[model samples]
Structures are given as C-alpha cells and as structure tokens.
Target: MENGNKRLAVLVGCNYPNTPHELNGCINDVLAMRDVLVKRFGFDHSHIELLTDAPGSLVMPTGANIKKALDQMLKKAEPGDVLFFQYSGHGTRIPSAKPGHPFRQDEAIVPCDFNLITDVDFRQLVNCLPKGASFTILSDSCHSGGLIDKEKEQIGPSSVTNDGTLQQSCSPKTIPFESILQHLTSQTNINTSDIGTHLLELFGADASHKFHLHPNELDLSESLKTDEGILLSGCQANETSADMNPMMTGGKAYGAFSNAVQMVLKDHLGSLSNKEVVLLARKSLEAGGFAQHPCLYCTDENADAPFLWQPQGSDL
Candidate 1:
C-alpha cells in the first residue's frame, strides 16, 4: 500500500570530540541543514531524525544507530516520498573489497565511534526505496564523491589524484586509513594488519557489509538505469572537503560545502533543480577560495527535478 507522500530526513553529524579525529563544524552543519529542511522544504520537525556527537545529545551518531535510523525511515517510506540524508564528518577511502572493481578505493563516512559506513551500504539502502520515491544525500566530508555506489555521475572529478591518496594538510575532513587503523588497534589490542579484522571484532555483524562480502558478489557490471539515488558530494573521491572553524567563519563552525549549499538555498527564491544546486554550490566554494569541488550523482531526469520534491516557486 502506498502511504501518502511524506518528507523524511536523517541528519547526522560527528565531531569525534576529544579524539585525534575531532572536527569543528560537523554538529553545526547538521543543525543548519535541519533548520532549512523545516523552514524551506516544509519538512515537519517531528519527522526528522537528528543524530550528533555533541554532549547531552540523546542519540549519538554511531554506525549502528545511524543505520537503524535510516532503516526505520526507509521502512516507512512509500511511493512519491521524499527522503533526505545529510552527513557532516570526516570521510575516508579504503582499497576496494569488490573483486575486479574499476575504482581502486571505495568512499566511506566516519561515525563518532570510528565505525565506517561504505558506499556499498548506501547503494543497498537506495535500492530498497520504492519505485516512485527519491533518496538524496548531502555529504559534507572529504572523499565523498561516489558515495552512492553505481549511481550515475552528473558532475564528476576534474583533477582528482589516484585513489587512496589525499592531501591531508589541506583537507582536515579526511581521516587517513592508517590513522583509523592505528586508533582501532590501540583500543582493541588486536595485532592484525588488516583493518577489516579489527572492525569485525569490534562491531561484529554491525560492521560494514563490505567486510563480509563474498567474492562471488563482487561484480560491478549492473546498471542503475532505474535507481533514484542522488548524491551531492563535497569533493571528488580523491579530493577533500574543508572544515571551517570558528576562527575562519568568525562565529559558528561549519563544513565549507554545507555552508555553500545553504548560501545557494538562501539566495535562490524558488526551488532549484539538483544540478542547479550543485553547480551553484561549486561556484560558491570557488568564490570563497576553497579548492574543493562539489559533485552531483543521479539519473538524468533527477538532475532536472526540483530538489527535495519541492515545487517551483516554493519559498526558501
């Protein structure tokens, strides 16, 4: 049975407080995105699930918690529904687990507790949505391009370097693979060279499904001609997103890409298409002297569809 079209969102921000991977702008990005969804997109505040790493937050943005929240939201979703997910945190790339995949590295998001959610997980989630529904993801983190596996890329990398190689000093939003491995080893005292083993031991079944994939299931030849996943990545898979601290923003911290998207939204009077939003955001970042380039991934039709399914002339 098709439920009436509803606006649903899952917003997550991880600061990784007091840790080596601590960020300064992620929580602020979530709060800001949430406000826009309610005020501009007409999303009911009650329908939005917010998870952050800030102190006193009721639900922390752990890997399991985030997956559970997204699962529940998708469960209630039906045809004509509009679903949105905003992630603000560090991003990383790891060698592909998929056998014979073209891309050497797969993109992933870092949760507050160091659990990573990979592109394969996102692709699975998007595949579960009903035919008429849309799931849009705004990832304000480094190495975020292609976060949705197999989705068509409307805007792609320009000068991205080889996979798994990132400029860390310029991109604080990127947490290196070595750093994550060291942290896990320190905590678990497991002397395995493979990071996947440590993640499996720490998170077990809750670990990223990429860790347990069978070699037979590694084919990437399937087409996404019928998929409805949209991704607004902060940068190319090999590039990094910038985190604007209080010192830089002169007040509240913010993910550079998140702030750019907000600025584009606020400046436009009517609803903008997905392609328009990403293009404007790219311009905004370039104007601000940020080297990061935001990219969009979705079907050709979705590239022209109104963002969040909001109609034309809808007020922002």
Candidate 2:
C-alpha cells in the first residue's frame, strides 16, 4: 500500500541574530524556495512547514526543533510519497565518526542554537522514509558538497556523465561560503581566524571538542555509507556557497546558490532532470558572478531523475 499522492516539504533557514555569524539572506532564501514549492512544484501549502530564526516564526531552526519537525513530517509518510527538504544556512566540517573512516572530518549543517547536525544524523533521517518514497534535499551552505556521505557522485565539482565517466570539474561554495567571501572582501574587523575563534566562542567549547574544532577542513569519504535520497549542494566539500545581496530586491539578501536554483525553475516550465538542474544552476550562478558551484548526488541510475521527482511505487 503506497501513498504517492502527498507532497511534503520542510524548509529551514538560520541567520544567527545579533551574533557574529549573523547572515542577512538565509531566511529570504527559504521564503523564495517555499514559494517555488507551492507555486511551481506540486507541494501543498498545508503540507509545507517553514522553520527559520526569524522572530516569532512558527518554529525556530534549532537542532532539536529541526529534528522534531522532521519527525512530524515522517509521521504519515508511506511508500510512493514524495518528501522534500530545503536547508539554507551555515555548514561546517569536523571529525568523522563512521566505522573505519579514514578522514578526520565530516560535513554538518549549523543550527540556530549551535547544536551541530552531522552527516550521520541526516543518514538516519533519510533512512526513515518509506522504501518506495524519495527524499530530496537541497543544502545551500559551505562545505555542503557531501552532506550525505557515501551517496553516489552523479554531478559534482567533477561531473559523472551517464556513462559514469568524469566530464567537467569546478569550484565549491556556500549557502556554505557566501558569507565567508563577503567577510573576507568587506574589509570588516573580522578575519577568517577571527571568525573561526568567534564560532568557537559562540558554539561553546563542547561543540568545539565534538567537532575537533578544526573549521574548514573538508574531506570526502567513500568508506562510510542510505535511502532513496537525492542531494543538491551549493558547493564542493572544500568550497563555500555565496550569501549574496539581491540586486533587484532593494537591499534584500539571498543565498547565491538558492537564488540560482529559483531562477532555473522559475524561468523554465515543467520539470528538469537532476543533471539538467545542476548544469543550469551552475551557468546561472556563474553568469551572476558567483564562483560557488552546485553539485548533485544520487545513485548512478538516478543521475537523470527529475528534480523533486514524484515517487513511483512501481520503480521501488
């Protein structure tokens, strides 16, 4: 018995308020993506939840709150259901915990309260989806290239074509790196080391110890291993996503990668394959003057699957 008819989305964005890591565009990015799900995609308004750091939002984008929201989203999921998750925030790399994993680091999404959500955590959440269902996640953050470890590398900084051969290789970025570049270029009182130290202070000494406190050390592990999940990341494991100011939005801000994704879907009608979307978003971001690259991660056979593809029970 499958329930392929329902479409559910959980959108999370965090702009740490009054904090040194405060960002201006993350919340805006989620809002725009949410609108796309409601208008262009088939996701219903009722089934969509917005979790952000904005004051008085229905739910805050804390680690615990986010986990709780995902639990709720998975409550009624069944085979053939389509699940969508969009996260626009800061991403970091720390030590790896996988069995026999060689790397000293793994990728994680930074929650509002400084509680880090590691790649292992995401793997668990992904496994919760019904066997026939699909979990599609878009992570717009730094060091986000391999957020779901051990997933196939379909389209990355180095692309894998339908024949499984490498095609083009490019740069990495942030929903993950935008603010990083912004700070580096703005001539502000902050430097990379300064910000790194600030993160230590903000997130506390325990988080620093758990993560080994080695910020920006990205490692891609093939050793560790999940559900039928597709990941669209803003940049490579070493690169950061751009949190850019929207030129047309009158001082408003948005994530560089998220904005590119929105442009690709908004300008085109109907659906596009995963490869197509990643390619288009790359072109759009490059044209817009952002160096951060986007990548797609899925099984080799699913490389050509449509973005946010509706689950077909028979295929499972």
Candidate 3:
C-alpha cells in the first residue's frame, strides 16, 4: 500500500492522568486524520505512526519518549520526506533554575505522567533532522504560540497612584510584571540559557510576562531554506485554545481547532489548499458561534499548496 512518492507522518496526542479531564480526548481525531491521509491522501499506513495514551502502548509522551521517537524518525526519514508532527495536550511555562542563562522560563507539553517534553528538547529534535526533510507541526494546546511570540503588551492595567505617579495596581485579576521579572531573577539551580534562548526564538523576545502576538509572519520556507519545515499552531502565543466536551457532539471532548480540522479534512477532502482549509475551518467555528480564532502559522513557503489528500478527478 505504499506510495513510493508519498511522505511520512507521525501523530501524537496526550490526556493527563488523575485529572478530571482526559488527556487523550483528541486521540480519535488524530486517528481519523491518519486514516484520511492513508486512504484519501495516498500515504502508506506503514509510513504513518500514531502515539497516544492507550494502555500498553509506548509510554505516553515522556521527554525521553519524545526524544526516542525523534531519533527513530531521523534515522529513517530522508531528504524530500514530508514529516508531520501533531500534539494535543497541556502546555506550561516553568521557571528556569539559573541566572544569566538564555531562558528565564521553560515551555512544555504535559505527558500522561504529568512530566513534560520541554521546548529545549523540541529544538534539539528539530535541529537534528536531515536537511531537505519538511516538517509540519500541529500543536493543539495552550501556549502553543509561545513558539512564536514577537511583540509585548503589559498584562495588567496601569493606574495613577496617590502621589499622582503612574503605577501598576495589584489586584486579583491583574498579573504584576514585577512578579515575572522576579521569577526570572531567582534562578540559582539549573542552567536555563539554552531554554531561554529557545523560548525567545519560539515565543519571541518579550515572552517574560507580556502577552504578545506570535511571530507568525516568518517565511517558514525561508527559515528552513533547505526545503525542510513548517509550523501550524492552534493559537497565538498569548491565547488559550479551548478543549471542549466531545460528548456534546455525541463523543468525548476535542479542542476547538482539532474539531475544525476534522471537519475540513472530512468534508472538503479534494478541493482545498492548506490556506483554504484553514479559512473554511475558521469560518465554520465562527459560524457555530465559537469566539476563538483557529490560526494557521506556516513556515513552509508552499503551505498554500493543495492538500495531500484529494478526491478523484481533482487536478494534481
């Protein structure tokens, strides 16, 4: 069933344990996605891998497991291979352990065990790939956009103090900028520069305490000039993507973006480009009255190309 010219794809999803919410809510979506790729898109099932929270399977997304998977892919993947990485779960920012290091914070994807695959690990994985292999990463979780923040905005409102001095008011709803600065300053344990540098590269320079737009305008194709990578995030760095109850739709919960992706790939299989896919998905969500923006951040110059899957009779 292999298509000699088709690319490989690896999909991963996670739902945490012991939490009221399930971590693998989107596992089915990923499975469905893989099916579409294989049956309609010309991909070989052997070329597609799925990792999830299913029992007795590969341990759910530990840092080591992520690395192991990457290593496996690197070994088998060759130039011109189109690689896709999809993740659905929680995202966090942890304080760094040392001072003067690049990152004062660390970003992560929460695994089933509550451990994380830090951004540091991701960068290393990306850097290790062979040139000319294209990567399209889709992350459905909070802070996914941290991989692309560029501008800075004050998180809390500014107020006038008693002495007529403009000061930031401390309130339960307001996050103080100083708190973030202080957290960054308190590191004395682990070296965090590399993590910090990676954070800045992914989330932008002002990621400390300010919410900023993800630097999404980067020419994905240009950055990976060797024809290798692209990124499509669920939300901007400063925003949170919703994970709603799937049972409401006669199933379990799924992130809003995940649901939309399924809709497009299933309904409009042959006639849409990635850009059209994103637009339709966004419109569908908005028409349903969801107040979220399903954004598409692509580093791939050819991101506008037609989808890999298309119905018969479609022009190639």
Candidate 4:
C-alpha cells in the first residue's frame, strides 16, 4: 500500500486527561478511522501514524509530541501529498485583550495537560506546508466549530453533560495569546495581525467595544479553504458532541457526527460524494435519535460534487 508520494496522517485522541467530561471512545474512533483509511483507501502502515491513549505499546501524543508529529509530516510531505489530521477531545475559545482587536476571541485545541494549541499556531503550521499539498482535518469535541470563524455559532448549553447530569452551558470564550501578551510585551507579528483581522471580521464593530456572546457556529467555508482539501467537524459551534457510552459497541460509542461518518465510510464508501457523505451521515444520526446536527465544512467547490468509493465490479 506504500505510495512513492508521501501521505502522512496524524490521528490524535485525548481521553484520559485532566479535563472535564472524560471520554471513553475517542481512541477507538481514531483506530477505526486508521483502519478505514489503510484497508479501504490504500494507505500504507508506514505512511500513517496513530497517536492515542490505547494500552499495550501505543505512542501517546502530548504537546511536544504533537509538535514533533507535525514537523515530521511536513518534512516528508511532497507537493501532492495528502495530510490528514484527526483530533478527538476538547476545544476552547478565550477572549482577546486588545481593545480594537477585530476578533472578540481566540480558539484553541485543549491538550492533555490543559494547555492550548492556538489557532495562530495552527495557521503557522498550515502555511508552512508545500504549496501543492492538501490537508483534511476532522475534529470531534466542544468549541471546535470556532476554529474556522469568529462569528461561528456556539453550541447550546443543553447538549452537554456534566457529572452525569445534562447541562445547558454555552461554549467557552477565547482570546488570542498574542492579544494577551501584547500588553505585556508591546510587540506584534504578521500572524497576530492576520488573526486580529479575522477576529474583527467575525466579531464586527462591537469586537473592541464589548464582549459579545453568541451560540457556537462552525465556519466551514473559512476553515476548509484550499484548492484540494476538506475539513469535517463533529458539530457546529453551538452544538454538543457526545462521548462514547460503554453500553454501546463498535469500538466506542462515538459522537453522533463521528458515528454517522463511520457509517458512511463503512456502508457507502465509494458510492457517495463528499456532500452526499455528509448528508447520509446526518440522516443516520437523526435516525438514531440525536438532537444536534452534524456539520461538514469544505472550501473545495467540488465539495458537493459526486465522489464514490466503489469496489471492483460495483456500479457507480
């Protein structure tokens, strides 16, 4: 399954951690995804990497580990390579400190140690990739939808569960670290400026005037922008994505959106377009009685175009 062109994947799931709402199934979900890509999509074992909390000789990825993984991928990736990054865990949004900041908040991926993987850092990483390469990122966790847009809708408070009790808490707010440090350091960089511009566009004129709060919304168009890439998120900014229930089977009970994606990959591999895949995933989730909606954000004009995973002799 090895292709001369380098194709690397970094699958990360942080379940056993110092965070609220511990997960029981995200690791299984990542493993399932690895299997799907390797067996069905012709990915080589050497080309793909899985970083999780699974027992029995598994490499766990942390803050430094994550940086190393990304660096390795970038080092080996060619122009045509396709890099896939899948994360299952928590996300947060903090408030920005600058008064005239365009964005009202900063978004981040919550690591195992409760440290933040800021979007500014992510943007720097993305920009470093070879021009012709493409990236596909799938995130299943709270506040992930905001990674793409400042005005991204926040998930309603009703969807989350705390201490076995269903709770209705809106998504958390985030401010860029640069904004926080600007006051202390009195210095700035291009990355900070870009983030500020995006934040302003999302929060609008009131970004600097006041702290405006809203429901979580995922901006697929802004996040998944690339001529050849796609971004698939578990839920909208305002929606809650569930952890696995031990009572369920098929690895671990997945978030409704992740579950639907697994179903599409399993049952309809080659017979659906990216849009169709998302539609089917949504239908499956609703049929299973999920209350929130799953979202598929992509910048590729052909995102809605037909794509099928057909087996030999299968009808297209």
Give the candidate number with the greatest TM-score. 1
Clashes of each: 0, 17, 19, 38
Tens digits of lDDT, candidate 4, 279-304: 67656756665544555554444365
Q: Which segments of model 3 are wrong by more than 4 Å?
A: 1-6, 94-107, 146-227, 308-316
Q: Which is the winner by TM-score between candidate 1 and candidate 4?
A: 1
Instruction: Give model 4 RMSD, 1 decimal.
Output: 9.7
Error of 2 at 295 (Å): 0.9
Off by over 4 Å in 1: 1-4, 101-103, 159-171, 220-225
Shift in Å, residue 244, candidate 3 = 2.4
Q: Model-by-model lDDT, in order? A: 0.86, 0.70, 0.52, 0.55
Ranking by lDDT: 1, 2, 4, 3
Candidate 2 lDDT, 1-316, residue by residue in tens: 2446788889999888787777768899899988877666667899998999898876788777787787788887878888888898888776454446656557888888656676755666676777788778899988888787567787777442222211122122223334443443354344544333444444444232324433333233222333577889988787777776545545667787887888887786766888888889988876765656789887764567777763333111
**TM per candidate:** 0.92, 0.75, 0.65, 0.67
Q: State candidate 4's TM-score.
A: 0.67
Predicted candidate 1 versus true structure: per-residue lDDT over 168-204, tens digit per residue: 3333698999899898899889997677888898999
Name the lDDT of candidate 1: 0.86
lDDT of 3 by residue, 1-316 (tens): 1112446777777655454445435576577678767666666788877777766675666544654666677677765566677777666555543345445554456554433455444544555556666555667766565342221111111121222211121001111223323333354333344334343433343223222222232112122323333445555444455666545346555666777787776786366765676677666666655544445544444456554424366332
Q: Which lDDT value does model 2 have at 267?
A: 81
TM-score of 3: 0.65
